[model samples]
Target: MRNRVSLSNRLKKVASYLPENANFADIGSDHAYLAAYVCQNDPNAKAIAGEVNVGPLNSAKDTINEYGLENQIEVRLGDGLEVIRPGEVNQIVIAGMGGSLITSILNKQKNISLEVDRMILQPNVDAKELREWLDDQNYMLIMEEIIEEQGHIYEILVAEKCNSHQSPYSDLEKEKQLYFGPYLLQDRNDAFMKKWGGERDKLTRVVEQMKQARQMDRDKIDQFINELDWMQEVLNNEKNNMETR
Candidate 1:
């Protein structure tokens, strides 16, 4: 039986970054959709779908069987990178999860850098933490893309292991870039600006709320103001660049 699965255009775009010849590991591979997509499209690619939950693991196995892709894809139930052996896969994709969890999985996996050549990550939140971890680990950020799907903006990071290292941006720039994305800062599309604009307004409200409170609250408010001011400045600079272009 040939069942059809639809991937979001954003996901398809991210998948395009995968290496031509790769043994791909799809961490949290719900339903095995991405593995199936890569196996079918990339002639030289094979995949393993790793899911921690039994239900998703079974679903992935069923999808693999239904597609007659048993030879090309394997589904295993385990947490994070624990499902794969070192050197078995060169490309890893971790999506549809929080940044903290993704970073934790990578951090906990021993010698993952020796096994994997590249990583494609899409975090639902806390992307700053993930970026920071990448910098610390000496993973070079190769590409970044932003997509708006179902009224939510998602950032996809494509990185590869690198020996040469540079310090991560200052805390202020890091916060702004993580929230708004460094690549998006260069392009400065309306969607990117709109996302940060909404956040800026939210921070403004918090600043106002902190202003009327006691000393302890005032200290918290000051911290928020400092962050907000930094982000605001970045946004304004991006806006000016967009106008000139």
Candidate 2:
């Protein structure tokens, strides 16, 4: 019955990371599509759809009711992790938001953040910031995935408490891993290449445009140049690997 709700490919990828019998919270659940989909698939799963805004909260309720998953998925109206108490859920999912915002949300509820067994984050942008936050908070990256759908590319980061496993980032590769996810960089799948390739092209155009300005933003230009250099190195290395293969 709950299978009536359709999820996008990106959400499907996020859902794949969930455990078999998860008691989770979907923060910023926006219509609760993910919560509904997961609960429908896992009979043992229970979820809370947390939405900060009233409208989305109501929409989430509608979805739960439509799928007759009201018993399995509860809709809550609150900001970020405040929707659920610490230790109430073992896993949390925060998707379709900017990295900085997601970090802020996690920071605001450090207690709940620490208690959760796992977190699956899908940041729309500034993924580097999120990765850095995860490192600082001692959440080790367990898995990372990149997918392209409907002309858009998305990244999913799965992390667990540092004590649960080893940290994937090393001092030598830390910087690069934070910018381009450790697992994703190692994979360098078609989607990863496409996403970074597009970003590199966009930066090239911006750098040229900036040079033509009456007064250049030297600092910004320098930053963009550094990013371009790093991107070029990754692209060239991938090319070399492909040729050898």
Candidate 3:
């Protein structure tokens, strides 16, 4: 089932955000490919590949053995952070999962997660919700990135625990950053516009189809209109400002 000859561009972007010489853990790691790759590149890197399912756990073990990364990468079978204890790893990666699941994993593993120095999260969707959770937990987003893969845009959030609550967004932009990420908005890369542009177009079609049903869908129409408005504003403003800044 594994087709990975090497790390995908998306995962490579994720790995690039890691701290140097980090002690890392990759939660829901399907085949430990990222773990092996990281270990190979960073001499001081050591990783734990955490998988909950039996099949994936076996797959991770095989990957570890195949790369002769047994000394560098450890394969463990457990759900989320259950396989890891507090202070075991300084950096943690929760990729290829939904935002809500990532939130729950962090919530459930709160006691141990306190020891984690950094988090590299890639949410398939609902990235806003995950950021909210991180905000509540006092994690400060240090950097953000978006990558396009197979016609899909993925958002990667790099955060670290902080003593005080310092948000990346100012009060004026807080609401906007909640839906579109803070650094993502500031960066405004092609992937960002493409993702939101596609979303706006999809909502446009949905609104058009709903109009045939008449006023009954007024509430939904209003919501879509709001989203489209914000997106239009962003693309207009950000696209123009890309080069000047």
Candidate 4:
């Protein structure tokens, strides 16, 4: 029987960021499945599976040991980059965490953050905030992916510290690219549209409720309207562009 380690589409996409033979770390590594999988597939690759909590730390160890990858992949228990010493790895992956927490992890560990050449991030929410934080830290957005699995839409960002700090937006509005993702905007797939379309519906409902309320907050209503308008316009623009082509 083949020993198989399954990765969700989101994680599989995350794994694609790794080079042929990478020195990598997976922070918030829930099961260390990604790390173990990569090491097993690429014999030359080595990985650190870092987990802050005991439950996940134990899971990571079990997975690595099950794969007999103890030599190639190490399971470390510590918060964020605290598990990763500077120069230990060339690529870093932080997945299945909130954007703010991801930013905090990178922010709190300057030494480890500066040592890596690449970063692969999958923020469950608040991705715009993460993009902004990456911009400030001089990480260049090199690739972006939007994947839908089990009815959930996940976005992955692959960046590098070539340190140019150049905006990837290419004449597009910075605010729009930050909120909507620069590469994702250019590659508006079904998952991306569905995610923003659902957001638009939710915002529209909330705006309607505010209008129907006996007491209305003008500022909140205006904010929701503005967001709703932006989403609708983008969706329409995509539609128009597709039609013209």
Candidate 5:
């Protein structure tokens, strides 16, 4: 077997967010499939595949060589953004990673803000933290997408560097937008609603459990109840918007 693997339609949808004619980098590129796809599909684009782990790095190198794209795709073995020199690529795609790891990578690689034109990120969880990090760094949220694949919902964020803008949203809007994506809130897609609704239901169960536990701290129980309420309100708002529209 020649290391058989393929990109899912969801990954392709994330790749579609990249601009045409852009130089791109895929950080943590395990098999280099996305980089190869971009190079073959977009004539004006070039890509770099950066992998930190030895196994994955070798796999990426083999994939690039097998595809005869050595000239179009550069494979480097280093952590996060360390593989790419400043200004080497305009668009950076970091996917298949946890939200906290992704945020930490971006936080440590602040040089990318000055070097790259845009960032396309797909976080596995804690998307609110990643969005809050982007807001703190003055990055503008250009687009947000939620896709369901293999019975799971993934959020992809497309952002651009910016210096002047109001905070991510008004105080209430910020909380709701961070928990549910800003664009997804406006789009009100089925996947988005389903994901948030499921989360709300889970939180409701947790709140009920906390309330019934006689030993539970009052403060902690109150906090859980508050979160459950917020999630319920947000979900209801999304549902109402969808129905009216």
Candidate 6:
């Protein structure tokens, strides 16, 4: 028998969002580790491992074969969501990519995107952009998580379709939630703090550099300053929450 495929802490967290008997498509499935894992865990679950590149597609196929899950998991060579037709799966997973690219993948196939019951996205960076796209697409943010693994922080976003009357942002201010996740802002976990703290420090240095420039760009500096202020407020709120508890 083939050895069971193991997933990193990041992929494990992403898998936690999958529902029972999940029939899902994993876009950009590099090695199909996640797909094999879900199938191994849930015999009823079915997965389509879609890869755009020849190298990764072959790797994914090898993984599926080694796992002896050929019957449960299907490996396809195609870009983004093109491999799977609309309504083929209830959930879609697009992880280990930038938020902008993930957004572009979903935007490219609105029919399949809207058809799925759920979508779990893990963006390496620009999660704020993903959140904004989800909002525009009317996908309700059902769950959000931040995890630190191998000295890097990653964010997982779980969303589902919502009606026009419903919104993903809830009552929270849209702008803040757009920049900082609505759920992540509420939790303010250590990973979230570290990520934003680093960003705040980086922006502070940029603002200082701009101030020293011979021909300063006031508009750009103002934008950076505004973002700094928002980060400060979020950090302060987290500190106060800890103090009160």
Residue range 154-225, candidate 3, lDDT tens digits? 999999999878878788878779889999887788899899888888888888888888465788888878
Clashing pairs in 1: none
Task: Assess each prediction's global lDDT (C-alpha) against the native.
Answer: 0.80, 0.91, 0.87, 0.89, 0.83, 0.91
Off-target runs (Cα >4 Å) in candidate 3 are 1-5, 210-220, 238-245
TM-score of each: 0.88, 0.94, 0.90, 0.93, 0.89, 0.95
Instruction: List candidate 5 segments past 4 Å from native.
Output: 1-6, 166-168, 212-215, 238-245
Q: What TM-score does prediction 2 earn? A: 0.94
Task: Enumerate residue pairs that collide in model 5.
Answer: none
**Who wins the TM-score comparison?**
6
Cα deviation of 6, candidate 3, in Å: 1.9
The C-alpha stretches of model 2 lying farther than 4 A from their native spots are 1-3
lDDT of 2 by residue, 1-245 (tens): 22467999999999999999889999999899999999888889999999989999898998988888888999988989999986799999999999999999999999999878899999999999999988888888899999888988899999988674467888898888899999998999999999999999999999999999999999999999999998999999999999999
Residue-wise C-alpha lDDT for candidate 6, range 1-245, written one tens digit per residue: 65767899999999989998999999998799999999999999999999999999999988988888999999998878999987799999999999999999999999888879899999999998988888877888888999899999999999998766366575658888878888898889899999999999999999999999999999999999999999999888888888999
How are the candidates ranked when ordered by TM-score, highest leading?
6, 2, 4, 3, 5, 1
**Ten-residue stretch with the least lDDT total in model 3:** 1-10
Where does candidate 4 clash, by residue pair?
Answer: none
- Alpha-carbon RMSD of each model: 2.6, 1.7, 3.3, 1.9, 3.0, 1.5
Span of ten consecutive residues with least summed lDDT in model 6: 163-172
Per-residue error (Å), model 3, residue 132: 1.1
Number of the candidate with higher lDDT, 1 or 4: 4
